[model samples]
Target chain A: MARVLTIGEPMGLMVATEPKALKDVTTFRRYVCGAEVNFAVGMSRLGHETAYISRVGNDPFGQHILDFLAEQHISTDYVTLDDVNRTGMQLKAKTLEGDPEVVNFRRFTAFSYMEPSVVDTVQWESYDHLHVTGIPPALSETCRETSIAMMKAAKAHGVQVSFDTNLRPALWPSEDVMRKNINYLASLADIVLPGLGEGKILTGFETPEEIADFYLKQGAKAVIVKLGTKGAYVKTTDETFYAPAYIVENVVDTVGAGDGFAVGTISGRLEGLSWSEAVRRGAAIGALQVQVESDNEGLPTLEQLVAYQNSAKLSE
Target chain B: MARVLTIGEPMGLMVATEPKALKDVTTFRRYVCGAEVNFAVGMSRLGHETAYISRVGNDPFGQHILDFLAEQHISTDYVTLDDVNRTGMQLKAKTLEGDPEVVNFRRFTAFSYMEPSVVDTVQWESYDHLHVTGIPPALSETCRETSIAMMKAAKAHGVQVSFDTNLRPALWPSEDVMRKNINYLASLADIVLPGLGEGKILTGFETPEEIADFYLKQGAKAVIVKLGTKGAYVKTTDETFYAPAYIVENVVDTVGAGDGFAVGTISGRLEGLSWSEAVRRGAAIGALQVQVESDNEGLPTLEQLVAYQNSAKLSE
Candidate 1:
């Protein structure tokens, strides 16, 4: 089986314990860091051979993440421990009063201080596929350089690279800086996944087609733009396709849905699924994600995925 | 001054937000609820004549007792929104490993269903102390009867009542039950203040006692239990107090630190040096809150009370 590697900083996540506003609630739940790590855990649960790469603090939270990775069966051979800084964290308020609000407490955190010294020790040649995201580039200069170095090393070792533009405005200095940095990272990937809104911001394109075209021209072999309930748009060298969103009964949270879509598409590619089938899998997984609370907790096992796909077809 | 009134459920508050456990946060903050209607908003800041009394949703959380009234400017105009059902809410998580843990979801949601017929219309003749917690015996047959009857007749007689036990649970069998039962009818209060932690189940409490104990004894006058940086906790009786917690370098959040303790404490009590010299002003304000993330915000505002008492002693 081909081995898949995902790298990024995962910080702690705090979400509202109930539907009440933040000022109203007297409690909250806690979860460990990074968006990409969440997806890695999901893919590993689907029985894929997956490895995660990142740096974490030397504190209990870091140990907790490591223990969590081991429990999820994702490889942590490439993970590093930082002695000085502590882990990062984010708090999501339980408010429907406005746009889903998130308060980040990750400034100057250990994840943002990840250095090239940590990256230099990784064994890049062992993985068949590598997944990267835009967040690392915006964290710190050292992390940005590490992202570029990892991509270059992966290319040299003939590993396919997939990139997700998980834009977080609070982490960056300005929109222009974020766009420039993210676009630069996209140029190093073979596959690019960008959410509809994120794609618009990164490529300055209003429509998915325009966004996909922009990435494809930048050297991505294929580009997929995630459109929440409406599905996704895919573009390749010679053709493009549109996949409709899977209908879900409720959308409890939309936080990790995009990451779920990326997992489906990337894992499908590794398994040699058809382009259409891969995008279909992406939409299917994304649909499941919104119905649950955690970022990757609702990801389906391979058997579950097949059953869901089969049921969808039978219903049609 | 103007007389203010409020009505709603008051829940037991346990906060678990500090780096240490719940016991450690004890030195953190304190305040009470059910009585929170008077102390939290009505009695302290508004300086209006205020009264509060309600049977709490019965459970260990029901220990709210007379604590809500002793600390603020509230009087026991009508107290008793009690129920056999669980008192809603528990400690909110400060870390990211898990979401805020709840003891129960208020299985019967007994507080909101208070009956209007049982409230004695003649009860409003005593004076101008009108306050209420969101939870009342109203959740069940006897409780609801007491709340509706008391509130409607009070309003007709020009008595001002404030309602604030913001939201208990949403899965109360139906939405119509929630909207028609909870907000629309409860909004008749003269002043209303529901906060972040008060609205959802998670992402709220950081400290417990400091957040829940500012309200006073049920039979007494006035209350307020919000614990914002240890500032402010007012109640009627013959004494009032103010004590701020030791300053901290970082404030994770100041969510419910204001509302759960503001109502009656700042608005109701008699104003004089004697009124400001009591430790119950701090003890009632300093109870078991501040350990959680949301419910109770911080310690009682007792420094002013101590300073005033010391000055009175020197004069004597």
Candidate 2:
């Protein structure tokens, strides 16, 4: 099993419990969520030894996130309890159709104030792979430095790195800065994962092939493009292929599909699967994730994945 | 001027910004509100020297409440910060009419877990009066004990006490227990304030006169029943009076109308106004409170109260 470390911010989420507008609804259910944490939980559920590294406030919400991570069997050795700022929070409105409206209140939060010194303390050599996202670097200058420090440390320790361009425009000062910083971090990873839409914005590439070639030319060994329901496109140097998406009757939520795709591709690669097989696993997991409500609840175990793959082939 | 001290749990309120349900709302505005805090703010704004006593989490929401109280000139001398528990919070829905729907998340909160020791530190003799609501004692056994202790301390020190039967049925274990405990606390006060509905439930009386006599027999010097838009009913030993509510073009919210009445009656009495004039002021303030959106925003200053009373009289 691969020992994976994922770094980013986890926030307390207040999701509307009904189908009414946020203003008209009176009930909310709390949950813990973050892109990197979601990826860690997905990887851990697939039998990978995953660790989550982040900082949270010394408050109840922070305690909740820590408890949730522990329950998911993700190591919390590198998590820090910061008293200077409160943990971040997000309020999600559950719409009848379309993506849920999310209002984030994370400015000057404990996670945004994370220091590079915290990153320097982690034992990078113990991890086989490291996963990072664009959200943390957009939080604050301190968080940006911490993200770079973590990526550089993992690279120095010979740990493979996976970078997801999960772009958030509102968190950063300017689009120029976001583009510059995210591109710099992408160049540091061995595997660069970006959705087709994010790839078009980040690389100014109109097609999947051009987008894959753009990231691969920038020191990345491979580029995987998430194409929503169509599937995932994997390109590694001289080879390129498409993995068709599994057919599902219902799509409960599509918020975490990309994260699930990343989990499948990274864990499959770690398990010595071929590039096309890894992309197929990514497509399968992405299809599964969209069928569930929460961000990471539908992630599959080893047996579930194998069964799902065989069933998909039989249906075809 | 009479120095007033009000005690209760202050919660961070997340209010939806639009007319949508809680599930469909994309934006929320944060505010610090609680019955006692609203009363304190009202009294302070009306030029009374007001102090507030409670426990809150050592978090940002708690900090916001403290800063807001300070800005309103309410003393925070007896406020305690607890690290072990989180501050209370409530999600309020915006309805087109009547009262709004509120979902409370206050279980095991810092204020609910407050110890009686915090109450013992307050210098009761320095304040001319103490104000409390039914919400705090219903929160937990510890809060109940603390409420009883503070009332007893105020009584022993010869400071007048105002008790508002701000009953929240969801906070109590049973209606019988709430009636028993709230009645016991009411007996310890010189002035008892109860809404017509709450009075009917607590005293088992159908009319304002019978309700006033019920509390008057329990050692209370005066009883005032809030009669909604109709006005206020006040009764003392041998005298009874009804003050008519002022007419307003719009009724923005009714959540804090009862608290506004308390502030008016108590502060008017402290200023040596006649019993009838105090009741009239209470009715006037109650009328004003229903014309604003926030809990205490419509609470008027001394000059504003005079102007409103004059305009109301001119209209009549």
Candidate 3:
């Protein structure tokens, strides 16, 4: 197992229990989730030492988040409770098929109140890997500056950095700023992950090869590309390959597929697996994620991952 | 001091800290508020033994409401926390003038989970007055039935019932249904209070005299009509008159003015004041409410109320 660190907001998620429009739905089941939250859960399930850093409101939602992270076996040592701001929350509609409609309440939340000083207390040298996402930087200018500071300090301390292009267009002030800042953050990481659809928007590149090459040229050691259900495209300095996607007949929900893939790829590399094997692991987890309703709930443990891959290979 | 009792929801109100549209504003100051909640605060401040009965979610907002009511010296012994439903919430935009843009998240809230069983537990006979609102009935059918049940039981136990036609058209299913139900609630009350604007819509009567008579013929002992800054109109079997409004130079938020008026009239009557004096006191409090930011923050204690009324008279 490797020691992993990530910085992001964990929001209180309220999912509708019935397959009705959110306006019509009255009852909702509460859960804790976010992109980095999903990533931490995946890493923990695969037997890694993981710690999360963020701020939540001093409210019940904050208490719930702390309790949830503890239950997931992820360290909350770096997490803090903020008094002036509220914890973020999301309301998602239940859908039988396709992506569920979501309404987010994250603006000016506790996580958005985070500043560059938050990075000052972290013991960066102790971690083997640092995972960062685009969402934090999109929250506010302070967060963007803080995110860059974290990656730079992690590098200064010899910790490996991974950046996920988790685009949140609504959070950004403008698309031009989003593209420029996102690419700069990507340039700071050893590994960069971008879904194919967002890759086109972020890089203005039409093909996966061009997109991966764009990031590779920006100083990243490897660029992993998500290709929806088709699989993933991988490119590194030494070699490049394509990993086939694990296919499921019915897709339950596609909200957390990319985070699952990131978990597999990051965990694999930490265990010293070759790029092909790691990408293959990522593809398998991404497939598993789309078959569940809530984000990260479908993520497999190390044993479950191996068994699932073996069953798929046998059927093929 | 009268033993005054009321049943209603106490909501978590988020008032924007800046003068901006709600969608544009991010910083909010939290406060506990609601129409009935405002009325209870006024009654409690006026030396009455006020008791509030309602359901709230087992969340931070619910805890805040509980703490707030307790601090206001209102009894919360009958309030219960519900695990499944959430406390209602309102998001109000900051405005320099006119009514603020408001967004409500009150449908299917914990208060709506109330049933006729709640009325069974209340010692209605021990109370001198039962203050009810039309807003509760508009929340949902269950709340409507429960409101009626409380009134019926209160009447059976000889508790004086004062119903406020606080018209909330959006909460009801249809205009026709809202009219019928609100009028029915008025007929069950010993005294009926309705804003002149709402009175015109609910009774199809253009003049306050006609509107008051509409309810008097339905068996009400008295009818009081709010006439905005122009004052209030009052009618009883023996007397009919208008209490001129205590004018305020610059009005603040008008959200809780009616509740403040109800507080004054009810408290005045409980202290054995005449109908004319009670209406005059109600008008003064209603004017005072529109001069402050929060709903009940401008409400004065018994001493302050007397001082304000006396000062206004001396100046006149």
- Best candidate, TM-score: 2
lDDT, candidate 1, B21-113, per-residue tens: 321231212233333542544244334555554445433334433444544545554555454333443333344322343322232444544
In order, the interface RMSDs are: 14.8, 10.8, 14.7
DockQ of each: 0.02, 0.04, 0.03
Fnat for every candidate: 0.00, 0.00, 0.00
lDDT on C-alpha atoms for all candidate structures:
0.60, 0.84, 0.86
Expressed as tens digits, the lDDT of each residue in B1-316 for candidate 2 is: 8899989999878776776655445455667779998899889988999999999886656777888899999999889898657677766666676587676667667898878887668887789999989999999999999989989999899999999999998778799999999999999999999999999999999999999999999999999998887777889876888877777666766778888889899999999998888878887887788886677888899999999988884123
Q: Can you rank all candidates by DockQ, best first?
A: 2, 3, 1
Identify the leading candidate in terms of DockQ: 2
Residue B109 error, candidate 1, Å: 39
**Cα lDDT tens digits for candidate 3, B93-170:** 677975877766665678888888988888776799999999899887888999999999999999999999999997
Model 3 per-residue lDDT tens digits across residues A1-316: 8999999999877676789765455355667779999999999999999999999986656777888899899999999998657788776778898689886666567898788887889988679999999999998888888899999989999999999999998777789998999999999999999989889999999898999999999999999988877888899998988778886778888888999999999999999999989988988888888888788898999999999898764112
Counted clashes in each candidate structure: 204, 14, 1
- TM-score head-to-head 1 vs 3, winner: 3
Give per-residue lDDT, candidate 3, residue B88. Answer: 77
